[model samples]
Target: MENALSTVSSTLLSFFNSQALIAAYDVEIFEAIGDGATSQEVFEHCNLPESTGHQLLVAMVAMGFVEYRGDIYTLKPDMAPCLLKNGTQYMGTLARHASKFLYPLWANSAQAIRTNSNQRKETFGDERKWFDILYSEPNDVADFHAFLSVLADPFVESFLKGFNFSPYKAFLDLGSGRAALPRAILAANPHLNVAVCDLPEAVDHMRQELMSSGHSDQVDVYIGDVISGDLPEITQDLVHMGWMLHDYSIKTQKCILANVFKALPSGATFIASETPLLDDETGPTFVALLSINMLISSDGGIESTTAQYLDRLCEAGFTNVRAVTLDGPRTLLIGEKP
Candidate 1:
């Protein structure tokens, strides 16, 4: 009982850990220490007062993000890839997204739970749809998608390697942020025609990313919305929506699925990737937390069990519905047009 209470004690103070990391990112302390700088050098680099800097450094050491040697502090080697600005797997964008957007919304989680709705008005004084407010500014749009792209990198690699794409002649990715999946598909299966369908606001940014990534000539871009039925004439034999279904209420998810079903060619395959709750709804801890986060921050979004997802697919007139587990963060719920 005492041990359980101690765990509770630690859990309650966990926000301090998050805030410290955010503070480090905000002050450029992690980047300064990436090169194994001493406390004084880090303070100088970040323009932090020495005493506060030293205190934060000590806290970081205790948190295992930094290692304090006799004279120098260093980012823990394993964390450097994710924490350092120049690292290939940098997730500072996610940190920034959390700090700027999610954290404040989560502050009103209790209110969200009581009301069973998003807290956008409470947190940001905006009652707009989640993406409308989120994508209001260009920089906010970039940060939101950039962090998602980083998060999707593993899913892309795993999907490309695990899922068979050779049977399909053309592929369309709906709401494809950063175009990472379609880009990977193009690289691995060059013969398959690829395209991405997204909102008009995202088309320009996605086109730029595709162009810069050397896929402009190969991948097509389409402006469409799955919810409102403003869909492009999809000639693609396979359509994939990665990690998208959980962004809205169950009713909206069904609407999105039905619209996509109407857009696809006969005998086309459709896949929706998601991180869902377990069958018993016990825990895949992050996903459970994500469901709560969605409650507070999204448009009535909630995570589902794999069974719930497959049921939704079936309800949308999909045939041959099944689930595919990948070696990454998402599970692909697959169905086909009759």
Candidate 2:
């Protein structure tokens, strides 16, 4: 009973942990201590007042993000990759994104649940849709996609290993944020034609990224919208949409699937990657919490079970609909247009 109560109490005050980490990122505390620094040095480097900055250091130490010894502090070795600005798995963008948007929106989660609607208007006084508000600023768009790419890294590695791209002559990734998958596929199967289709606002950035990565000539970029049915004529034999299906209402998901179905040629393979709930609708913990985040911040987005996703695929006139297990956080729901 004592342990259970302690867990509950910790859960209730979890936001403190999140805010402390975010605050550290905001003040560049992690970067300041990257090479080890005394509290005074860290505060001076970040231009933070000594009293509050010392308090934050103490909090970071307690949170295990920093280690304090011999009057000096250092970023935890394991956490450096995620905390440092130039680290391979830098997550400061995600932390800032949550601090700027998700934190405020989630404050109205109760109202969202009660009304079965998004809390965008309540939180931001913006009546526009989620993406409109989220993509309103260029920095926000960059941060959003940057964090998504970081998060997708693991899934991309797993997908490449677990799935075969050799069977298809041409591949197109729909709503490919950062076009990570297409880029990876092109690298692995240099002979196969690869392309990416995304919203116009995102396409320019993706094209620029491809150019920077020297894939501009290798991979084709097209502007398209799956929900609006404005997709380009997809001649690709295989189409992959990553972590996008759970971003909208079931009705809209169906519509997106239908649109993708219409765009693909006969006998084409389609794959949508998603983090689904367990079969019993119990917690995968993160997916369940993400469902609430979607409720408050998105257009009726909710996590579905694998079975639910397969059923939706089947209903959209997809044949051989099945869930493919990958060695990553996301499940790949695959179907073929007959």
Superposed on all Cα atoms, the candidates' RMSDs to the truth, in angstroms, are 1.3, 1.0
Per-residue lDDT tens digits for candidate 2, residues 199-311, read 87788778878889999889989998899999889999999998788899999999999999998999999999999999998889999999999888989899999999999
lDDT of 1 by residue, 1-338 (tens): 99999899999988988988888888989988876999989999999999999999999899898998889898899989888877867777878889989999999989999999899999999988888887788777777788788888888989988898999899999999888888888989988999999987777779888888888988999999999999999999999998789999999999999999998889999999999899999989999999999899888899999999999999999999999999999999999999
- Candidate 2, after superposition: displacement of residue 49 in Å? 0.9
* Model 1: lDDT of residue 65: 85
Task: Give the TM-score comparing model 2 with the true structure, all chains together.
Answer: 0.98
Error of 2 at 198 (Å): 1.1
